[model samples]
Target chain A: MRISWITEDKHTPSVVEYGKVSGEYSEKARGEHTSYQYFLYSSGKIHHVKIGPLHPATTYFYRCGRSGPEFSFKTPPSQFPLQFVVLGDLGQTEWTASTLKHVNSSDYDVFLLPGDLSYADTHQPLWDSFGRLVEPYASQRPWMVTEGNHEIESFPTSYPDSFIAFNARWPMPFQQSGSTSNLYYSFEVSGAHILMLGSYTDFHAQSDQYKWLQADLANVDRTTTPWLIALLHAPWYNTNTAHQGEGEAMRLAMEKLLYDARVDLVFAGHVHAYERFTRIYDNKADSCGPMYITIGDGGNREGLALTFQSPASPLSLYREPSFGHGRLRIENETHAQWSWHRNNDSDAFEADNVWIHSLRSSKECWNHTQDSSLDVHDEF
Target chain B: MRISWITEDKHTPSVVEYGKVSGEYSEKARGEHTSYQYFLYSSGKIHHVKIGPLHPATTYFYRCGRSGPEFSFKTPPSQFPLQFVVLGDLGQTEWTASTLKHVNSSDYDVFLLPGDLSYADTHQPLWDSFGRLVEPYASQRPWMVTEGNHEIESFPTSYPDSFIAFNARWPMPFQQSGSTSNLYYSFEVSGAHILMLGSYTDFHAQSDQYKWLQADLANVDRTTTPWLIALLHAPWYNTNTAHQGEGEAMRLAMEKLLYDARVDLVFAGHVHAYERFTRIYDNKADSCGPMYITIGDGGNREGLALTFQSPASPLSLYREPSFGHGRLRIENETHAQWSWHRNNDSDAFEADNVWIHSLRSSKECWNHTQDSSLDVHDEF
Candidate 1:
């Protein structure tokens, strides 16, 4: 986890504490001094300091690190409304620029970039350019990123170094996932539990990530969080001809675990298009199945994926060949709104919009548990 | 000028012709042309097409469109040794990675960058992280550049963008000069006579750039394939601190006659890095400057200067606090080298080792004329 702070002055003398009670940090730090760490900037005056990597679902108290006066904050509640902006394949293109502007204008507390950032390799200049472009928003909010195929340049060496550089620049809940690697991790945003899977890593049953995923899912207290979100780079249910069946192997490896766990949402990108799917279980529409959304429209030079596999595809709800981004807003325990905005050269008002409601909250939604004999291998 | 010709297929019949000679294009374009201006891809089968931008340089013809193969190219005796690389402020940093690696590995006939590169910004990232970096042996030849202040960001902008990026990138004809705009312009490499002057534009008259510099340096002899090189960023020799003395109020405002005369090799990048100085003259750096290099180190997080100014004191080389970049080599009458590498971070050896040299034959060094009577102002 990375944290940036803003302070009014460097010599303002303040102290920071974290514990069960907002004003009782010193008591909590009695034995485990490792609970807190402090640093000071030498020359330029610091106006603020942001700290993170806190344990998921745990409440903690924190305060400034000086005498005379101190600012305190309670960790975000374990159960509260959470908002995330999801996107992929975003580069320094006109469409990406528009999506960023729109997202920034809206109220997203955090951003999730599921692969294909800056695009095709980690060029320092390109990354710097990307940083400059995103600084307006990231400087104020958290921007978490995942690796895509394009980000892999040299293996075993440069690739890992680039990832290190990326992690240094952006903060994420990497430690919460129990995996030391940032390529895959999980975090809880208020009442919702989210798992970010790493498609770039080995996903075999014997791999540590798969085992960790299973352990994580099994330990989740569904009665408390009530919602589970899984995000990855490759779409397991995509009908786009470009990457047809490309992720089938991965699906065969882990889909059943996610299905049985009743995951609420699945987000993915890679086909260079925007696509959303209705609830599906075993190749058939089922209200109980997790909703899957593909937001690959984040501006890339590759244009968009315009074709769908077939009209009879039960999972396919909407697909557009244009470029844009996605926004997800959770209003309560069982209702949320999702929107997709397409960015054309025209004015800003011409955005395509959509809203997705939770299955528990929608009385008209269909249930699929009655069909126990459905074959999961059949393609719609 | 560094030019890359990319296509989707290598076997597809294609030709490039200029003057009276024509040849089949040998390289394949990477990805589908996403936009009319850019070709996208990371790696694959690759090939190249090259030529010089110098006068009497190899005149050639090329056919890219589907209009059939009837293109040709020819050049007068003056156009020998034709290709070059243009770069700037390529400090040895992560910011300079992609461009440095690519340009260093590519077969650019020659190279050149104006100024402010490999800035010894700080001790750690500078000497240890960037200084030792090297790009194969391509830089061992003839690299030329001006100096900028970031070369000594530890000092004030006294180093100026001119000397910083310039010194690191290229091997200019003059060094260790006492003139304030020593960051300023004008010179000759190969058959091309180039001009480069510092940006401190405000202090026009008493400003060394104004008094010692002469306009209408020469007229291009079409029969001899004459090519002229004129370079400067803060154009005027006098102005405020923003642009220093760009000479905009004096020399630049009166450069139309020189533009009509056809000069080349005008390169500059300050306003916070990265701009291909237009091939203009009077109002533009245009084809008159035909090929301008505004390779401000895009990697620099600091603001790339957008304005020009005159020197505050004689020791003033530049007035901003930032980093640096570099250029490569200049070859023949038509081709010159250019590139921009930043001083970020990388494990690679010799981060700050960037250079440009003529590919054909070496020339004798020129003599410097010192003026003892000139008034010298001190401002460290």
Candidate 2:
């Protein structure tokens, strides 16, 4: 696992000491630090330390640098019955705090954020503050995220490259999965193989992300990881008017690949609203296609996207504009429960619920042709 | 060493068979490939094969994709007395052919390009042509290059990220040196420690490139690699009015780091002209700084930058608007010879020559304080 923190002193050494018990750190690992730039702003040293080969599902207490308060975290389990908290657009706001509180209501193995974390925009210092804000919950569970349009803090002539601060601070395990960019990557946890795609980057047939996704999906053995899920920023299928057709280009470029892979679910966040669609592909319903869901209403400053298209499409099962989060509890290889809870005055209200079957376990979709041909049969 | 090539067949096994002698194949290695996109154009499968652990400075014959004409390349010598042919802005044209013919006239250990290789400029097919054009010389010698602005074929709303083709095609040994980005990296050749910096990317004090440079330079021991060299796209100091102040921001951001490291030479491209500066620092003549050189005049189609500023700066030693190339021959740890050859109709004429002393070998520069204080003395 990799641990990252910031210090005001650039000269201080980056050292992380950790063990299984509190107040007794047995192992020590040294890390590296770098600085970030914004107009007339100078950031402190951002340090990252990677210490692993650790036992899964075990608690580890760690301290950053030589002298500091110790923090503890539990690694994700390697067996079944793991849970994941899925949310996005989690900016630093009072509602964000409430959403986090609701998320803390239950135990999750990991947090999957499609995009738009912190909403730093271009103010680089917000990243440091956001780090402090999420340290409480994020220190306990792993947070795997991809980039969003907000992460592209590109300044015209000064900073041409996008995702400078985000990439430097929130680097994912991309190289481990043969990915060259931090914007996209994949990781296997418990019985699920999850792909975090990049909607803001190039996703054409020739793009690196597309090629990587193809190789990654082809290498996935459905027997080991039966549940295959994907996440990106913009929703490919949506009834919301805001940011309409934003992801159509990406969908046109890469929808068939996911459809052919028999992906069970595709979660996206960008419309600032919550909407769930039935298994769909190419703007139509298909059993082999993934369940498209937009869960961007995680208490961002942009407020809720209050409007939807008149006479919702048949593919959209449910749609709402509210601050909430979702949970995916994988009970076994073939069964899983998905629930969305909306933040209310005192507690979070369960707005929607569903039980899903892994696409690998479905006779109709599982036996689909490996080639480009996708003909859903009635043999289920 | 990583060898890269292009194949039309995506399913063709990315295999390389090699041996010490002609056609006596003894070892084979498998590689990987990916496709590229531009408009409606589709690219061939770009293949990369990494094969090493063999003896350096030895000739090895190899064939690509199981069936092809056998090709051979000589690994760079691990010892001193190595030669590097340096040029940049090499666009495909009749003049480019002449420059290659001139470069092929002598036996060089490796080819060093500052940037602007293909001038593809959004036309992805041109990259293949450029690769084919340089195969004869490039296949035999290792070509070490950084990115130029021309490599940024970013189509807004489609290809937002730059250097998709350049990075995928010509990947340097960046990860081995702890660099996270392919835009910048450092390597050691013979008695020289060379740094390939990205002029188009972020170079502020807090940028990743700046921080990586700090770590890389601090780890360099002058006792072993006495010659320190740096390469980028834009020339920091130039008398030509064409690209005046183009590299000023980068120079202001990173010049101090290189100066403090006692870099011996700084090579740059972008301005289509050839100019060499005396050992200077901060727009003034100072012996402690590197001898800045602009050798972008390697037959770019845009033509040469013919106009030079009136009342030439005293620091600029030689200035010309001609198609030419340069050769840096490192004879030993302390001494080296630099020569520039201009391509005439019949032959490449030797235009400029200079003998350089490695900064580490100079008594005045060798004992400079480790702090930021740089006070050159006349204690020679």
Candidate 3:
């Protein structure tokens, strides 16, 4: 259902026009206390009308004078450089606040939880706790999210429905996905194409997601949109022992497809650690492969994964299990800087940095000239 | 700053023993992956160990294995009940997917928002948009919020914060009163005491908030550990034309003596829409007022202040401007039936139909008859 707002003039007493189209009015009778009206349309559309202009930086929920069902929405000002703080594996624990504080300082457009949000078995109260913690931010900016392992605690029933609870409180683009599910979907932010993938679902070859992924990736044109980033629950080339091979399986299933399409970057969580890999392909370090980043340090109960297990091959670049969050600055299409913030048991601290240069020219690794096939020794 | 995650197992490889009597431990240089560690002492003091559990959920800016400085953290698990979902003035725009979908499915403990949630500003994303939108069952649970004039925009910054940019990414206790500020502070959930009052700061008077607010409220009985709650954007009892007696002209300046008490709920959102009052005293609503509900319909771009001008003495049994948000069940408080959910243009649906008997019996409004002084008159 669709909902809209209307305003009233001080000099004139008139019913605010909720919709420009005919036949858009509230179905529920109006009450003196009820200054607004709700309406439901024949097409299941909903609308809301107010007495006048509303306050800025506030949240609202309404239906158009009973013309349709009720819906909720928040209002934000028009501005640029909409800040979006992106991270994953943010368990509902005390540490989550630190990361939130840092992100909150910036004028971000949204808070993106790529996946692995709350830890496993987080019940309603836990969810409430998380809500309150992030309320300071979500109440202001849109708290956008994707599915993660922790969100899938209960199988079919609770897991899928849990998202419904999240959606009810916040609004998202669940309909964007071809499948009638919130699991996987796509949305646009200015000039960026954000593809949210679901790893818990069937991501194997011939799977619906595989086909969708291919189509979505192929549809992107470098002209209008030069940045293409994909978010999932697990990482493809993590070296942490806790979730070492967890995403390798999924990577094998979709890496080539993503690589062939030249996807720009990929973000994932799950392993309770932080890891960033150099661009690589098929178990080998290649400049063309998407840069893989794992930011699963969102504060949760489970401790961070600390051991790094180098692959039999030399694809792994760096790995750590410190609890923290990552920040990415998409400076144009060719230049991006990524940083990680660690929670040092006291207050949050800054820990790592990486400068990403697009591969528009040279196709070789500027930092490495060693045998590409040599096996790197396993080190923790 | 950039930070990386490192596990304890990678550093010490062996556990160290510390005397239980003393809260001190010997520190040794750790290996590559493990750098910092923590341990709890019998005296309740915490110390750092060569390889021990680091402070959980704190933010640390440290480097990994002699790398550069980066920021990172350990996120808490996505659990139920205590989790929170926060947002502000996030209209149902094209870029709202990430915030909506993410908060929807992920588990949260609680949902807390200061103000200006729905874009009641333009009425484009209405209440129905909120009701039918899915994030899992948060609709059926608790969704708590304060105020933003977007709930009542036409009135001016009559609401609070005058539509300043809200920070939804972080969760902080809105503490401090003598220091009046829009979107003010203080509150609590479970074991935590929170402070959330700040909307209209520049003014002062012998107002309710001014006559009773205090910092000692944080020193509650640890044995009982009843959470403290405090919130206000425009000081619900203010008196202004645009706001019309809203917030009662800064109550904090006069209410600094009530800090030594315990408060459970404190909520506020400008007249634009809705809010729930807490049961505390001073700016702290009492058990008599554990909850101070105010639905500001942040969604209303056009403000709605029909009641303020209405001869109705008591501000609102319930009022709507056309857009707003509500605070659902807080942590498992001992008292009060689950409060009702309030929105802008829709019939108040029982978002969660649970009875907060504990809260109800302990509060002042328990058996009090509905105040008839304020005539709620509207034609349906």
Candidate 4:
């Protein structure tokens, strides 16, 4: 379990107390913070504390600030059939509330917030407020998040540390998972090992992330965890005009590694819309390439990106520009189901549904007979 | 471990998964909420999930709201030297920040927010906001709290659920602890058994609370948990002009029961200041009477109660009108220390310090010849 708080002295300590019950805690640990913020009249020191070696699936109660409400969380079960809630670009808005309402009732196991969390955009207070806004949901689930463009609130003339708020508030398990930066990391849960990559960081073949990604993929054991999923803020496959070609270069640089690793699915967000891509790589149908899905319309103030390419690619199996979230149920090592629910529709009627089957036994298989060149907007 | 969320309908389900590690959870339990809200512009269905039969002194991790940051908490160890923080009348204000800073730094195990959280009054939105404000602290530690005047945000006479907001948000373990109302409950830690009473609820001998209090105290096993601490909102013994005699009626009805039970200390708040009293009952010193300490000075915007009783009660030991909190360290089964700190002073200089020794075995042992009364208002 992780708990955090903010202080102004840059030295006020951060602590966490955890055990199986209240008061009788046998462990006491001090935590540290990274970066500082001096915005308006409010200044802060972000603190992060990690409590660990916890009993898997056991319920543990904890509190972050010295005297706040006690929060508890149960670790996920180690095996298959885990439910996962996937969404992106969830900002503080009425529509965001609608999306959360649906997501909260979905009864999923993992929450993947692929960047653009608060849309603070240099307005740091929004970031703090947004944390509270999502605490009801985020603090209660394993929200595996990544940095999006909006999280890159760079103030060229003032503070140089970008993602200051995001970094301080949500400290990912990067170090434990063998990644150097919170921007990217990997962790195992249920029957899948999730790779949360950084679209805002370096993606060159020689980059640290790339080398780590290669090693991480090489270490995956299909016998224990057969599902491999990669999450990034920007979609490599999209047919929407917004954020078109934004992640194309990155995809070109890293897609081969993922395909080689036999990743079953890739989730992303950025374009304020939803789109599901057919299993393909380098613009051609690939039986082994991971199926890509984008569900970015998470109720940000920015309305949905309604405009799609005039001539949609056959690879774009589904597209919709509406505020919603997705649910992925890993049925087993070989089969998983995905569903996208629009906020405006009935709770039972999914806007789109697809079942993905793993092809882990096939090694690096892909047919290059299709289109040689990929269209950016058509893949959104 | 317990978690919650909200939905439009009253039927949305609640769930908590907990065990040992992040993915080895063996327990999955569904939970439910009791009350909900539908304000002017907002609507909600509160959710509650409980995960239990947790191993004592062990750490467990779980989440609420379907998807959230996984929170971890350790069950309290079976026994002593537990640190308990005692404070009262805290509300959301610039002053509240100072109090929280000090309290957070003190590293207490149990946070006693004896009442007046948020200062939301009838503004129901502040209730939601208050939960987030104290979450950093309360979510970590076990904050044993009770209702104060501010929580008495009575609606129109037509509806008698005066504390609906407070009741919905802060659900105490009253039922689990044997009490029938969330307003009053008792929980044990180390050598101390804390009784959190409701000053707002009925306290007459015939009242349900009175009956419960009698049974709870009668059942205390002094051999194992030798210390008995009482916490309520309004100070039963105060010399401040504000809230003078506010708790007199209740005190008249319940003080003897506590005195007979050989209560170690009575902590309360309501007046906007801090005050300590020599052990006394029926306007006279009694070595066995519970020591009365009022640490209500927990940063509220209403400012402080500067005026004292004209002919200050001979029992008043110390009094101060300032913004701060107090620390109670149960050194052991026989000795405990208390300190009241001023928010603006150096950390080491406590306004008042006292080492209260237990007199549980010596019934009515006061040698009244010591002095009529003592006063320490001059010290503060």
Q: Pick the candidate with the highest TM-score.
A: 2
Q: Sort the candidates on lDDT, descending order.
A: 2, 4, 1, 3
* Regions of model 2 farther than 4 Å from truth: A1-380, B345-348, B369-380
Q: What tens digits encode model 1's per-residue C-alpha lDDT throughout A1-380? A: 23333233545432344555656664222110111111111122222233444554345555444433333332333455667788888877777788788776656656878887875242334555675576566554556677665554321111223343344433456666677677788887677778888776767788877878777776666556667888888788887755555456677787776776667788888878888888876667776678888888888755677776776376787787778777777877787777776666333343445555554344443133112112222211
TM-score of each: 0.45, 0.52, 0.39, 0.47
A1-380, model 4: which lDDT tens digit per residue?
Answer: 56666655655668777667865566667777666444332436677787777766666676665655677666666677788899999999889988998898756677988888997655566777787788788766678888887786543223445676777677888997889999999998877989999988888888999888877876777678878899998789888866566677689889987876668899999889999999988888777688999879899875688888879989999998989889999888778899999999987778899888875534334222112112211232
RMSD (CA, angstroms), candidate 2: 19.3
lDDT on C-alpha atoms for all candidate structures: 0.50, 0.85, 0.46, 0.76
lDDT of 2 at A179: 93
Per-structure clash totals for the candidates:
189, 0, 366, 65
Runs in model 1 deviating more than 4 A are A1-160, A169-171, A189-191, A199-207, A233-260, A269-274, A280-289, A296-316, A319-336, A341-380, B1-67, B75-380
Model 1's lDDT to the true fold? 0.50
Q: For model 2, state the Cα shift of residue B232 in Å.
A: 0.2
Model 3 off-target regions past 4 Å? A1-83, A120-122, A155-171, A177-179, A310-314, A345-350, A359-380, B1-380
| Candidate 4 error regions (>4 Å) | A7-13, A19-29, A39-43, A361-380, B1-380
Q: Report the lDDT tens digits of candidate 1 across residue range B164-265.
A: 322222333343222334455544434565555554333245545544443223322322434555555433222222333323444444354344444444
Which is the better candidate, 3 or 4, if ranked by lDDT?
4
lDDT of 2 by residue, A1-380 (tens): 88888889777779999999998989999988888766445678888888877898999999998887889899988888999999999998898999999999877889999999987665565788899999999888889999877788765356667888888889888988889999999999878999999987888888898889888877777788889999999788878866666677899999988988889999999878889889997888988789888999899876788989999899999999999999889999988888888987344456888888888888888766344322222211
